[model samples]
Target: MDDDRERLTSKPETSDPLPKAEHPWVETLKTIGLSVVLALGVRSFVADSRYIPSGSMLPTLQINDRLIIDKLSYRFSDPVRGDIVVFHPPAQLERELVANGEKKFQEAFIKRVIGMPGDRVEVKGGKVYINGKVLAENYLGEPPRYQWSSTELTPDGIVPPSHYLVLGDNRNNSYDSHYWGFVPQDKVIGKAILRFWPINRAGGITPQPDYNN
Candidate 1:
């Protein structure tokens, strides 16, 4: 009976609650803080979101289409032909006109890389031929599309070293390399890799092929 009584009186073993589980508020704040940091990191380094503002890149990128730009690519290698990219305007343009009367230097524009350094690009008879070979473009939407005016390089316009010549998929509306000039390599901001908005139309964009050069 004494042994039974002693055993009953002895304290039972118990586990301390899980390492003082963090307070709900503290956990919530930590999660929020981490998310903000991650977002900023993505915006600055990995990827960023942008909206199409004009018809310049139409057929492939429509007006108001939201896209996710891949910021990690150019860090390791140079952009290639047919990769759609975003870049700043050239310096020769009038600042006031380019900024559109805005106070800040708004220089971001999106277009497809049609020519790279040392490439010979030309438009003839409504078709784009590079280095004497015709290019196959499967992205242009319909049969009634307006092809840009045929123009040939008066002189061999070598794509400047470390620069790319870009064009809008909508040949008639875009103000791209044909109108202005090549985009300096340093000015390329990123590549538009995916379209994430509008649930019904969400998918990755396949970069166009470049014929053997």
Candidate 2:
């Protein structure tokens, strides 16, 4: 009887083995959540892609052209003339757009840097002159069809420190700095570096060739 009692009282062998397969749905949801978080983080802090929605950069960037913007490089260096960039519109321009029935105002403007801070800029007689030198801009899909009659906008004034002047390739009709004002250096988001969509034009986006040389 004592032997029987000892055998019966012996602690049952512990069988706490973890399940071989985790709850399948729980793992799937976790994986999806992680993927989404990683994608958003990369987009916000690394690089971002945007689609060209207008002809402002025609012949170079077409409508629906997919571009990969280099958000990282600008952190190490300031924008240079000829670098294509995307930036937020100035506050006054935003207000104007909203008041003009564009309640859901478009996000940002893309243009090429034509002048940097402290540089003199002038546009007259169908040519853009920088610091008294006529800039040779051959990238314009079409010639600048409008002449600036305003003295304040003439290449006469020096670009403000920490500001840049930009213009679209489609100079004749683009709603850009010429229509508004300078893009503050800090407002610049990133330089456009590549055209990844529309297959035919997929390649490295070129900065305007240096004209100073």
Candidate 3:
């Protein structure tokens, strides 16, 4: 039976030889290309990861702390106070960076939302007040010590429509909306869902506030 089976399968003639090497390489290339595309699509639309770069979010997020962001959430619900977020640098901050000749990763910055759209916020006497109430920022390593200067966004400001006032939990150290401006809704990339770095601190991030709207 083995001899008969071997005789039944004939080799290709010289005139009709198959291009064996090319087919394997082409298939491998196509597979690799598809995999890359799929990965990028998932990262852009489904979810992505980021690491804490500064002490702004200290006490909550430490430098080099990695996070998994939920890019899908903001599509359905708006950001709320207390939720940690990742967003592209606002235009004002970007311009300042360029003018100063600084070279930093031009990626998004992460911070905790302090005020939602239309909320009145003021930082004075070393405290952050939102909607006439001081933010109970238990996550801070210390009370906000830096006063928001006139050049900053305080002195009782109203958050613009489709924007949010975000600050680092490390209020005194973070360069956030206080130094720039509100994070436009369009520039928001996602909600910080979990922290998966530094081993012992592996857990969910600060929960999002329950907003009526």
Best TM-score among the predictions, by candidate number: 2
Candidates ranked by TM-score, best first?
Answer: 2, 3, 1
TM-score of every prediction relative to native: 0.76, 0.84, 0.78
The better candidate by lDDT, 1 or 3, is 3
* Model 2 misplacement above 4 A: 1-20, 149-156
Q: Over 4 Å off in model 1, which ranges?
A: 1-27, 93-107, 142-155, 210-213
RMSD of each: 5.4, 5.4, 6.1
> Model 3, 1-213: lDDT tens per residue?
988887789664557657666687888999999999999999989999888877778888888999999999999999888989899987888887888897785678888998888788777777777666666666778887766632356454678889888888887787888777888999999999988887799999885543222
**Residue 197 in model 2: lDDT:** 92
Tens digits of per-residue lDDT for model 2 on 58-119?
Answer: 77788899999888888899998889998888776787798789988778778899888887
**Global fold similarity of model 1 (TM-score):** 0.76
Better TM-score candidate (2, 3): 2
- lDDT by candidate, in order shown: 0.77, 0.81, 0.81
Total backbone collisions for each predicted model: 0, 2, 0
Q: Candidate 1 vs candidate 2: which has greater lDDT? A: 2
